[model samples]
Target: MFHLKKINKEKSDYYFMSGFTWLMGYLMIKCEQQKYRMMKIQKLYLFNLLCCLSTCTGLRGLISLEHKVYILEPMEEGNTHRLYRGEHLKLTQGTCGHGHNISYPTQMTNTTGHKRDAQSSTKHVELIIVADNREYQKQGKDVEKVKQRLAEIANYVDKFYRSLNIRVALVGLEVWSDGDKCSITQDPFTSLHEFLDWRKLKLLPQRPHDNAQLISGVYFQGTTIGMAPIMSMCTAEQSGGIVMDHSDNPLGAAVTLAHELGHNFGMNHDTPERGCGCRATVDRGGCIMTPSTGYPFPTVFSTCSKKDLAASLEKGVGMCLFNMPEVKVLYGGQKCGNGYVEEGEQCDCGDVEECLNPCCNASTCTLKQEAVCAHGQCCEDCQLKPAGTPCRESSNSCDLPEFCTGADPHCPANVYLHDGNACQGVDGHCYNGICQTHEQQCITLWGQGAKPAPGICFERVNSAGDPYGNCGKDAKGSFAKCEARDAKCGKMQCQGGANRPVIGTNAVSIETNIPLQEGGRILCRGTHVYLGDDMPDPGLVLTGTKCGENMMCINRQCQNISVLGVHDCSAKCSGHGVCNNNMNCHCESLWAPPFCDKAGFGGSMDSGPMRPTDSSGVTVGILVAFLCLLGVGIIVCFKRKTLLSLFFSNKNSTIEKLRKTLRIFFFCKSKKIKPILRPFIFFDIETMIKHDDN
Candidate 1:
């Protein structure tokens, strides 16, 4: 029930890799019943799903990333934005770089950014302000609260940023614990793992860092409690990002800053490749800036996040900055660098392709697409075409003017590069210029009859999965640009046009048992978000939707999910001990060290004095002797089996003789069998009957 858009050869090639690997594995495993007995059918299914999700989403593990983002939260809130009781509000609309309408508080704005201008445009900043009151009840900072809030914020930011064309990132060192247990690490990579407690990867740079300088892996996060209008308007104005919070968690405030600042760099929760399947992957896990209330535990993205980020670089988007040439790079193909490869060659090989000529040399480079040669690689006349402009706009370009100015521009939005006849994303994926309408990736995920992500590129399974909505002012999917640019979504969502899906991790749909009076408490980790009165009956739609305004979080509000990530352990032990959250159970003193480590033998152990190792030397000596005897018997049997079997030709007869021999060897071992082997013993039946009677 899905129509796959014709992905470019390169994209298709990447997508099919796991399939190839799985197929090969399946074939080889089928032949290995004797060689091995692993990877059962159920395991294979999970493995297949994992592979598909990873490939479709382009998810990366810790090592896959090229750029890392760190969200910082200030411990002190004096300098941050402020808000009052009436001024504070729940999320009202969707925010940038996050997802799933399922995200709590769709939209929020506390303060705006520096204004939008050529410079700000280059800076990739879009401003939206939302006042957060999740922590209004708590008089002070709660480490647990901060942890939860950061997860929500990260999830929100993941989807919002992707949609807004802003990049999303993670926490470097997540500070969580009671004041006495505050975590401070000396390790450079903020590994939340180690000696019984280790760390996770695809990490964002985190450590004590300076605020004035914006380093690649470092960012500032904190809280504020001063101005309301300023915070509300900040989301609109991009002067200096601020979250109005008279009494919000410092973590929330800090993450808000991180989320907003990320926008300043034109990052979005979405990757350059806006496929439904890909976005689903981002939302499946929490983003760095998701709201804290939803997921309050720690979790990190797999390394595939690197690929999503790469797509942005190809599309002229970066953390805190926009690269102009990248726009050209998107058009020219994700390869050929960011500018003119052969002055905008007709084609740039997939980043992996290496070509040698005066035009390009890629022997050393293995990751990026191959570059086009400046000389013989391209036609002299065709090379004159500008990478961004449609063929008609460039001299000697075969593309006609209609292609650029027609009802449909040559390269639609979300598609950065046009390879003369078609447009493609930086992921080297293509959208059919015309005819097909569905987003192949989404349909494959939701199947039929399910509502597609809000503002679906097209309707039905055939609908366009176009990452960027229709380009015209009145396009059906117009929400894409407006949301990305931080503009009002014209009467679409608030009025209930099937509320847009704000992308975020761990969306849970609520089904209340009874209709509440007007107000009810929103429970968050034993904390109440509301006072249980005044507000009308409302149930937040978090499941399956992206975090919208929820992205405007301020800290490392984390949550753990098996779907996203699970804890790691070495040898997973402590004899019969189960490992959970990276912690091993030593059971008790009787179980030495890692509780799963058994008394080096394969048996469930219990603490008792009937132990086998009670008398080490004596027990060892006896065991050795017993084993030696057993080994000698086995060797002797192995040597005699064939010779002994030669005389007992019949299969059943041989088995009987072996059994009798075994019994005699043990019971009547003192009597040798040499005398009984003579042929005269043929009086068989009558002799056996007489012997039995006697």
Candidate 2:
């Protein structure tokens, strides 16, 4: 009296329901063979209700439904990595020039420079700053001014790098000049390399270590403004240097210096031409990689820049920054005296008497094998013993004399009475038998009065001569639970939806147990229960709906049409500044207006241009007149001797006055004359003309 009918559904749904009926019957017969008792078939409405809870609220919903239980399984795919930390940075700055002459001293003002808070940085980066400005020293440039300039430059650089865990310190300043002249103007990059080569050979007695990054600046009367070390930042080459011009603007100089060093640190310009994904232009203050640094400077590094820098570091670029004098070994450790081999030792065992092997040398924590001290397995007890050696089983079983024969001689193998032959032991079971046990047959149940099992429909006799058929626990052929023992039968799981089949032992579902959505139907493929419209595209959707935030619904689920936030104000706040949670751009300094546009903004608004006032104008004019009179008096006092000498020589003849002018020209023509005195001679003639005119 089991009646099967097709309900109103789609073509695929109808086929799925038909297959489900067959699958359910097969599972019930398979489970009965395992001696599982027939249980009352649960109503289809109960399983359908469980599906509704599982879909909307996840595992918690399934928990509320006492009949179904599920565990939250972690998906392996979508994991995010944390930022890099604890990298080391070593810094150096060397100022060089032509050997004999002093170059212009670059000014480093500590008071006027930017200083970053490196101590509060999360990344544990160690910084060391060293400098050598010998060329400036030889020419009598002001040492104090040079030191000030270095401090200022360091401050500015530290500010720029503080967020990156880079701290800068001024460690050493020394003069390193040789030869008569060393001008770097002709070819600054080439000149820097030559200077670096010379500097390496002349490292200070206390500075011979190769662990720190060498950053140097060369001062010279070169036509070139500045130059950085070639291949220093892009490759594994560690040492990098810059050529600096003292005459340049301090801000511009610092910026340019930072730019060159950035190159050495594996950063490129923020344009597609430089391999950046985004194009950096005047309008877009996206990054600092562009050639011209304008009014509103870039405040942050671009995503491309950060990614490339990380990639370069991961590729071993700039590792020379970690090479330091304090490091004792390539693989870092402490010496032997600190109660461990970590200080600077290969090994460190406690005492000589405690060493198990006689050859063990306690003083060095090594084995003296044939007069050679060995670190790895040096003692006899540490070495592997050979086979057939007489040994005790273990400390607990020392009384049993055992002969070692296996690969690990410390553990002896079991000896049989006969080799390659089976023998019956005293207990009568075949000992050391190579044969495997016989496979068990499937358990079959007899039909009551040949009416067949409660819900089973006999299909055919299986290959094992068992009457296998579509089976279930109930008379109506609806199963409370079903299980299939065959490998082809695999496993059954309960699935509830509009048109889906529920398969399992009726007791519990194993392997995977995902409940179906409210209106969603399920399809069984092997042991998997696929739910919803996603069953058609198993590859498209992983678990939930396959639609994105910016998608359109074609049928029931979403499909991608266009993406959001690509060119909107959200993309880095339109490149003006960092975007906050409220979706507004908080602009950086030198930037104004809403979008952070660079055209209208120049400098800070608070420090605008000043206009002349009536009172200030009168005061400025009076001060200028007073200064002019004082300058004339001082000129007459200092040039009296020259004026008197000229007056006596010109007093005799009319031709003497003309000869006096020619005499001045002859004085300038002489190379022996110092250039410093030329300005005074011109000033004296101008004063005499003014006096005669008056």
Candidate 3:
């Protein structure tokens, strides 16, 4: 009876287990099907949204959406999949004047003024981004959301600049939760000026960076969406720009910001006259520097932009971009394969697929075995270069060279001549690592054979406060007259060049005849470019121009260069060196720094030695000295016996002479002749002996 009951219980348990297994299997299958349906629904919703954007936004060539949209979701941890779609929007029609629309003459080659091999090297822009109060409010006053949006915009900008061999590293992000730090107005020019001033006086002192950008939610007065000073990158006063947050999507603002930043990099508008080559057609996104951006946002730079960047760099613009940024201060959290050498990382060459460094293991962001370094100009074959190795040469008259420290795997940061220092090969002063002169400016504007007009022309024509002759526009947007003392700092006047302003079709020549007191009249030619109200007048004399001896243009005034204390700084160089922008002495090739009084391999403390230590030469000198000493010792040893015999012979001749002299004296005494006779005889004998000795 017991055995029968046990068997029945076992059978019941087995049946229950089988039923439970079947139920669990059915539920799992149902869940998988539901997941698939959800994924399909999400994809459909995204497709419909894209279609609506394309139709309403007038985005053409978007039918091939698969090729246009890029998904970068799984790359970021905890971040949802983001779909970058639609063509970049047309934010502004303003053009940058940094290049001054100056067209190079066909006969004049090498317009860049210097070689630009440095363009091939990667440049990192340590960027700081700020969001205005309006932007903060537009994002529901959520600081985290604002920060996220700014980061995303920076990512897009980085993507855009990557092709140009430039990296936009976001070092800091700030949100003005309380209010705007500087005044923000509808006038784009005024807002830009105020923001730049604030950046120079306040933000720059607090946090150091290569450049800064302000994103605002307020719409500008006109069609202008962004503005920046052209070719002013890395400057303390104007290395920044302003962009309006015009689109709900961060990509739109990103494109606008990138356009303005390009202006700072000296890139001009890709106008039809330029005939700029662009890979992307107008139906696609076009190029980043297009004057009038439209439906599709431009994500690529044109050939003109690339050429402009190269020219600007060769002219010493963006001097601070060569050095790598401190990865510790990077805004984003640390992660492997981010292309930065962070804490605990031996080296980082980017992600596994993009990394091309043989010295690095991309999967772990670590250096390969026996590899000392994986990056930097000072690192070669995964090893640090010797101290005094030239890593960067001077690009222009005002630029200084950089060298390797030997101990570090990177070169020192770039330095240049101090402001107010006289420029080399140019009749101007160095300011912000550029030698700006009226002659150079005229040549750029009017092609070749252009010279600055006489002083009388500048004095007479610039006195009138009009569009044709003015210092610049005031805060209220009206032209301001030039004071007599500041006349040279006003609108530039030239005498000879091409028939018309060679800059562009939009530029017109303004001629004025000044009757000299001596009775002859001089003609002054000036330029006016229709660059809109957003840009500063390029016709004005650029700052750092030599308005007078020891005087330079500053804020529309002819100020003494003494104010920069360049003389004081140069005095410390001990007449053997020049002062760099950091106010330190850059020594001569045979002198040491900090004073340049001692002899050593030359360079400033900030930059490594200019020449190598010459270890091989030192070794050769030591060997030569040792060989010379050995030769002298051998000669002395071989001649020892001859020297000894000569000494003994001389001693014997002296002894014989003494004995003969004694015998003569005794014979003279014995003869008893006159004492005078004896004295005469002794004297004769003494003369004979002296003659023999001589």
TM-score of each: 0.20, 0.26, 0.79
By TM-score, the best candidate is 3
Summing lDDT over every window of 10 consecutive residues in candidate 1, give the lowest-scoring window. 208-217
Winning model by lDDT: 3
On residues 53-131, what C-alpha lDDT tens digit does candidate 3 reach at each position? Answer: 1101111111124226322222133322233344433234433323335343323222235343667888999999999
Which regions in candidate 3 have their CA more than 4 angstroms from the true location? 1-67, 70-116, 612-619, 626-694
The per-prediction CA RMSD against the true structure, in angstroms, equals 30.6, 43.9, 15.1
Q: Which scores higher on lDDT, 1 or 3? A: 3
Overall lDDT per candidate, in order of appearance: 0.25, 0.30, 0.74
Task: Return whichever of 1 and 2 wins on lDDT.
Answer: 2
User: Candidate 1, residues 280-360: lDDT per residue as tens digits?
Assistant: 233333443332312121123222333433332322222123211232211112223211233434433212222333333
lDDT of 2 by residue, 137-231 (tens): 53356544343344334434444554454433233333333321232434454555544444444442345332122223454333333444322
Question: Clash number for every model?
Answer: 152, 27, 5
